[model samples]
Target: MRPSTDHPVDEPGWGPLARYVIAATLARTSDGGAVVAIVLMVNTSGGSGWLAGALGACITAPHLLGPFVARSLDTARDSRTVIAAASLAHGTTLAAAVLLYPHTHPAVTAVLLTISGLFGPLLTGGISSRLPAIAGPSQRRQRRAQGWDVATYGISGTVGPTLVAAVSAWASPATAALTLAAGCYIAAAVIRFLPYAPAPGKTADVPRPLRTLTGILASGPLRRTLYLTVTVAFSVAALPVTAVSSTHTLGVSAAAAGILTAAYGLGNLAGSAGVMIRPSHTEADRLTTHLAATVAATLLLITLTPSFPLAVTAYAAAGIANAYFFAATLAARNEYAPDNARGQIFVWVGALKITAGSAGTAAAGALISTSAALPLLLAVALTIASTLLSLAERRHNRRYNAPCGPASPHTQPENGRPHPTGPTDRIHDCSNRG
Candidate 1:
């Protein structure tokens, strides 16, 4: 089940990509806002803090189902229909949860929120999985699209929580929840107009979920990307805790923590914009490794900095590296994923990152009381480890005379012919490279 190599007569231009960014941004904004909105809603409604935590669990735990949900989308006859329906379901269920939380049983509210969470991947990875097709077979276009896709995430991360906080402060948490739900609904409406073609004919030998998982593990490029992604996610998740701790250590006002965090977020946005203007020509796998090293270095700088301003500068530098790292991750997915397993690859990787990030956050919380610098140092170590892992794999591939390109032997068909799924014509033996 290869992606169709034939180009459409009316090859989509930036129009479709713009719409995709809009839809993705809206969906992601709602997702980010939901956390703050739920906490505020529960707190204002006289619920215990633990109840809010329980409902947050309901939202997050269903992310484990992402791979299965993605499999359903991958096999659907009309992916657009499936995705749009999922979007609608996400919005409706969330709206219902917000409305019912005050009056209904806690169990009932949890059920509704869980249902919304079940469809969460459709808003994130499901949307991302379509980018390669939307950008056509042109690698340059795909790279540019990846940059914009990353930008949408950065924008949503900044806008969502701020939106929720403002609305909750001025109006009410219930109103904020409804507003977030409306954003989801709007995203669904926008998604329907995108240039998504109907799914191609099903292949007789479509890989099962387990087989797809095996393929992901066996493919060196993908395996390396996922490893690095999870490590980076874990490290980044500690930043918020680290920011607050650093402020306390520096004897600055706690409010300055927001300033430090905003520096990173702004740097991310700047980096994303730079990628959009000048997309990298380097191979995705190689770029990912380089960016990981850069992140490790920048994080190390943060740990070494004694002054708050210097720490903020280091954080911003790390954020820039992270932005490029994330863009490289998307490029790797677009370049290496099998057509039939693409959705699952994206969703499963996302699920893994979410799990790692949660663990990192919990770990940071537990360790922050001891040393403010501990989590940042841990992040630096983890990123360096991930970078070394990638470098070791590349070294192994070279020693074995194997290239990590799409046409690598690992991706060969059972008939012993290379079945390259991505642009690999330019790829050559690893030994021939610098």
Candidate 2:
């Protein structure tokens, strides 16, 4: 049986354990990078565009079912075992991909590709579920966990494509991609094997993942968070697809496209440094509204950007907005959680993200090549979406921030009791009527 509660950093498992946490997270990020690398490799090597893109999707497909799968393991009291198994599965798949690449041929490649890719979701699910157990009950720690994950994704997004280029320069693109991906698995194995203070694991009465997701999504505050998150995700997925396409095939060089992409990343990095902003509350609803305005405003500027420098500035601003948006959403999600079903909650949140991202990506695919109106359409849609989110925030703010004398919609009378408001409190006090 696993130990109850998360282990402190000084625990026996703590030394290797801290490494495990950091490395496993970084490994996960690198593995995600590998997925993108593989897609780019496939694309450049005359593979079907759809097929290559689909391969990238294969790696992330697990997040959709990730929460549920992890929940099942939690129910079984086998979280540690599940994570261990997932690590091994991930490593083995990468090894197998490398071994089979040479002799397997294209026909066999497709057949075995699914088998290797399948481990991705399982691994992600396992790692995600065990985090709370490993991190203890601190909110800051939890945010750290999420931040680590985000940093991984952000850095990977920035560096992965470049790695593909570097790898391909020396070896065949297929070989290089596989080699790099396999390296990540090796790193993951080392990280995963490092000792962790076992957690008895989270047990909950909420048996169904969908049920928790549904309940949270049904709540106005959370539902709006999900919607805005999706909006952002969609816009993000679209920008890379459309911006690159328009710049690349139309009139611009790939170098310029890459520069613009870098600008987006820089913006995210700037935004991610949230500690710099004071009085900066992350009450999910308020933060979301603010970010929505920032990003929506940034995107509005996107369509108007005429030069590369202007485009880059706008993209960077958009990224900062996005980073802040995600951070706020996560903070709020955790704050409102019932405590018993956080994993399930985040999973459903993950699903909403996937759904939103997928929808956004699909829409971008349609508009990237065919129309000038696509980016504008996306920006306009995002603005409308943000405005609605702002409306929700107003509602959210009122509920949480109630008035001084009476509980107005602008504020919640905390403790379900309004502040002592009489003639002494307000000039309009009812006592004056007498």
Most accurate candidate by TM-score: 1
Off by over 4 Å in 2: 1-21, 40-57, 60-63, 76-81, 101-112, 115-148, 181-206, 245-254, 275-279, 386-390, 393-434
Worst 10 residues of 2 by lDDT: 417-426
lDDT of 2 by residue, 143-204 (tens): 55445444545665566666667777777666655655565555555544443433334554
Residue pairs in clash, model 1:
none
Residue pairs with backbone atoms closer than 3 Å in model 2 (clashes)? 398-409, 398-410, 398-411, 399-412, 401-411, 402-411, 402-412
Q: lDDT per residue, candidate 1, 194-221, as tens digits? A: 7655453374445666777777777777
User: lDDT (CA) for every model shown?
Assistant: 0.80, 0.57
**lDDT score, residue 263, model 2?**
83
Clashes of each: 0, 7
TM-scores of all candidate predictions against the true structure:
0.91, 0.74
